[model samples]
Target: MVSKEKLNRINELSKKSKEEGLNTAEKEEQHELRTEYLKVFRERFKKKLDSIEIVDDETGNNT
Candidate 1:
């Protein structure tokens, strides 16, 4: 999971972006934070999908 502080920073940067604009460093930071967040999210989602067990109702077998 992304740290709470990083998430907060991401939000702050986003709001700042919409309100005014970001300096180059801030833009880079935001990109890195977002990339990390997406990477973690995709990993968790893939794990959840891998754990899913589908069964055939009639035969009571896993598919």
Candidate 2:
């Protein structure tokens, strides 16, 4: 999970973008934060998928 502070910053940046817009540095920071957030999210999702077991109903088997 992304840190709470970073998440808050991401939200702040988004709101600023819609309202007054961001400077170059803020835009870069937002991009980096979003990339990190997506990376963590994707990793966690993959871990959840890996932990799932598929079962075959007809044969009473698990794969």
**Which candidate number maximizes TM-score?**
1
For candidate 2, the 10 contiguous residues with the lowest summed lDDT are: 54-63
- lDDT (Cα, tens digit) per residue for candidate 1, span 1-63: 999999999999999999999999999999999999999999999999999999999999999
Candidate RMSDs in Å, in order, are: 0.7, 1.0
Model 2 C-alpha lDDT per residue in residues 1-63, reported as the tens digit of each score: 899999999999999999999999999999999999999999999999999999999997996
Best by lDDT: 1
TM-score, candidate 1, is 0.94
Query: In model 2, which regions exceed 4 Å deviation?
Result: none
Candidate 2 to truth, TM:
0.91
CA-RMSD of model 2? 1.0
